[model samples]
Target: MGEVKAIKGADWKLEIGGLTELMGEKEGPALLFDRIQDYPPGFRILTNVFRTQKRAALSLRLDPNLSGIDLLNGWRMKLRTFKPVPVSVVEGGPLFENSMSDGEIDLERFPAPIWHEMDGGRYLGTGCCVITRDPESGRVNVGTYRCMIQGKNKVSVKVNKGKGGRIAMEKYHQAGQPCPVAISLGQEPSLFLASMSPLSPEINEYEYAGWLQGAPFPVVPGPLTGLPLPATAEIVLEGEIPPLESKDLPKEGPFGEWYGYFADTTVGEVPLMVVKKVYYRNDPIILGVPPLKPPNHYVSVPLGAAALWDQLEQAGIPDVKGVWGFVYSAQTGPFTVIAIRQRYAGHSKQALLVASGARAGAYGGKFMVVVDDDVDITNPYDVIWAMSTRCNVREGVDLVKGVWTSPAEPAIPPASRSPRGYTMDRVLIDACRPYQWLDEFPQVNVFPKEYKRDLEKKWKL
Candidate 1:
């Protein structure tokens, strides 16, 4: 397989206008470009980093057949043996190839796509991480947040409630000081993966990225924010968030979000980032990832599945053979299916309990199905078979309502603005033949291996 190409700013163009326009029409790995009217021509915009299972496997250095949980397990194992090294400043690097400062800084020059027609403005940063630090604890946090370009040197940043950046911003707000921040764009795939992972509080994503990379990530402290960033990153934007009351208000977001539709109209005052500096290597590459409906390339199903498995494991769920997030159901976003080797009478129910509370399963999922070890959770056909024959809706279905939910989810009623927890229904199917009734269920008809081989050898048709 050919190695993936790295995008640089000097040779890239920003052509597409909105996220819907760019993502809705593309069928496969899409390279969007036409060049901005003012910026240099021939620049490229790359999206859909892991468009196929093969690509996702390659990104994690695993076989395509491996489950998402398998990849996470592999990384966790490697992490045990890895240590991160700080990035040293080199004499010259690609990020330094182009420099923009003061009057030269013009965010509009780049073709930053307006992700959705309803979105407030052009979003410059999606596939990027904003690094910040707690003023008191000195611990660092890296999080994925949407940023909109407001001017040549300003941006409107949305940090979701309860996120790490929001907490950091609050600390600064209380003290009446600007919160320092650094945004890193166009980083390595592992770094991007780590940024999206749910790490423990105060755990630097750079170190996690280093663990994933099998070496320390190169880092350079931002001049203004002093936040550490990937040295090999295509672009870096250093800035600070002013106090909430002092910040300017911007109309933000009708943007189509991960929920498969334009998010509900919401108006709020967000932070305004005054860019202190912008850094890029020669021909720096800017990355854009647009979220559309399910079955889309950027769908969060795989990640959600992996997270579910992790959560189950953490919760001490036993005999788990595998876990899968069903892509077909729109209500659940992803239906979690688990196959477990039965060790007790209610083993399947135990598995369902763990799954329902599992991080990925709890947040986005609405349905849960548990099957005997004989069924392959990864294969939808096999799971459906168990559900059809072995599951009893009245007896097997377990529903738990009033669970915690997020505002991002559309299922919540309008009256409930606070996080609402809905009931989860779990079904356990006994696919295995009854232990005491071997004679009750007749054996399936099948030709012997030798006979099958001979038949194939003799038949030319």
Candidate 2:
């Protein structure tokens, strides 16, 4: 934002908004805005924090100059060997300077923005991470979910039924125990990345972030909630979620979702968090990352690719070259591509089935393409061409019915949806050239590499 201001000055808003419309208009940069309106000055808000692959490179401690697929591939490569560092819990930090308790735990003191005009309400926890622990296993979990400001000292958090955080809290609820929770408003960027990631239960984000940053992710136990809180966080809301059965629960969003749709749901009751304590520093900044259309997913997309790649490789799927999760047009695009070298009659289908059904391609992908190794799956154009030229729709296309999917997918016919949650009809397109006659397939035209290399060397091109 500072760099943008230095260049655009008075016209920064137009530049920022235009550039953030998609992941990359031209050499996309990760953007963070303190605030668009002056309603709440100095209560810093973060938007499009990791809007592009180039901007996301910084999380891997890589050069910011790297852009596009190179940046995505770089992070995925590093994550293959990435090891998380354990967190060192400290006693306290700036988060404790101004404490709120008793009757002062109001949500209205800070300036929360109505980010987009169509938003349902002012959201406080857009970029905030919710922390919870399993009552039985004591395993900790942190995740990013929508929080709508409902009343003073009260907010509603969307608890997706299958989400790890929800599962952890549900364990407490089923055991008739109050779930201890904390919302860290702003912390290190790496921490936010981890919270947005789908990490296994044994791997806490603190350690994962520590490895990404090449240092320990410092944390402290909250005084009230006792769950780990970022030591240098701008603000921390320590609270508890009381177990509620379907009667008279809190109402959350008609808000815009990351899928570029307003989430109007039938189940009006989602989990509510009653703020018990509020801790903050002087002039603290709240990282506000709401569900913008074509949502910025720096950590989710690339990391998810790496995880999926590893899954396919470990499953003995042969000659898998790469994977890329398209994050545009969806919160972690339901579109994914896999590059593989066919080895047998059913090899391509096997790769597709293993990946689409695996954890990496969860939430029922809308369109998954299995491209031949020649296709650069990272490039959208190349993937499209492969789909058009290489695929024989009647012969190559297939569907997997009754798969778990997000409730927000527009493709699911209205009559099929109900209170039981969503099931998807996933489409898989074998975009690879038919392997049966590889020897007879036409080859692609290209300039000779050595000729171009020699010319460039002499001309300094």
Candidate 3:
């Protein structure tokens, strides 16, 4: 189902990363690299696991034939049925086929790639899951945070402020205790998806993964940290993050982000984890999901838009047909589009306003557009055509300032950014025809969909 190739360690990073970028451009198959320049024959790395709709659907246990907004809408309905499926604790599994402790630890034994030329160091945890528990409620949270190797037994984790893992770690540190952590380098695809989802703090990711897969996820207690580790994981690292001042923490990141830019690198800003134990299968496969530039995303479908659609409906905007995003991240990013069937004079504008500020569409957002239901929101051409024909420049666009955004946004001036948080302006566009003049508006020159389908059937074209 994918390509397997051998690579030399001297030029491994560049070759692998270059190949991944090229394949992403063309929507290519998964890549499996083995026989490294210095590593054993069976040691390997896998990438592009969810780059195709078929693969993404299969990973989430959904029907593979679904595509576009239909697929996302299916997931949205599934989300409504979510219930916590507690994980199963197994005593042992393939994850413990081999083990290493303090004196024998050497992270370099496994190949960590420099996915981008500008990356400050080798990142071993791009696709990995960082597991932490809240000290106050004992609630476990699994998140996908970048981890870069600093030493044989140390990896600095970039847990951004306001993330569940970061909040949990800060709580432990405030109590003068070390925050226990477990890093799973590779595991079932459902687990990885749940780790990166925008789940609420009260929901445990392990349970969410179980719900996604329709079965209880199996995990084992870490030998040292007692944190849950994926029983079938390829590699697992047990560690703890102790309270330390900014000066004492190691430098972390200038890595390429999903937003298609290298975020600012900081010195002594990230938290450092001291690994105490390592467990792995006989021949581990590291899941490498390095962020590529815009138009080449890690996940093919606009999954985030599904949540936004749900929020728009909940906000009381009626006749919502679909939602799609372009150049997106975990949530919506630079451009988000909403399709709705106009029911009243102000229906379209109401959707534009609510979607631009809704919890699911607000973060990392730049442009928000609302189009009529007839336009294919997933197609850029269709969306742009609606804007050109229906919207009056003077009446359609509104800019909202000081909106919520991430620090990775390159548009934010360095002088304007504060250690506290980041914000940016969002432009909301109404592309639907003016409902006030509904009966007087010009009709689109196009064949009806049902009539076109009938012609296609009769002509056999």
C-alpha lDDT score of every prediction, in listed order: 0.64, 0.72, 0.87
In terms of lDDT, model 1 sits at 0.64
Model 2 backbone overlap count: 0
Would you list the rank order by TM-score, best first? 3, 2, 1
Task: Please tell me which model should have the higher TM-score, number 1 or number 3.
Answer: 3
Across 1-461, the per-residue lDDT of candidate 2 in tens digits comes to: 33221111211223333444443333254444543443344554545556555456665678778765566667667777878798988888878889999598778677665544555666777778899988878888888887777788878887676778888988888889878899888888888878877677789888888888888988889888789899899988898988877665755556666666776454456787889999998778777565555434423345667667778888999998888866532222578898998889889889888877776676646677899887878788999999988898998999987777776676677788665567776688999888898788888787777989999999999
RMSD of each: 5.0, 3.4, 1.9
Q: Candidate 3: where is the Cα deviation over 4 Å?
A: 1-11
Q: lDDT of candidate 2 vs native?
A: 0.72
lDDT of 3 by residue, 132-190 (tens): 98888988899998999999999999888778999999999999999999999998988
* Ranking according to lDDT, highest score first: 3, 2, 1
Model 2 ranges with Cα > 4 A deviation: 1-41, 264-267, 295-301, 328-332, 448-461
Please, what are the lDDT tens digits per residue for candidate 1 over residues 1-461?
Answer: 44243333322222343432344345344344434444575444566666556566667656656544465455444444645554454444566567677777887766677665556677888778788898888888888777888889988776766567878888998999999998876788877877766565756777777766667777776666667867788888887888856334666665666666665344445677888788887555667766666556353235555555556767887767666665522123446677677666666777777766654566545667877666767667877877887676666777766553344566556676432123333333445434444357555465777888888889952
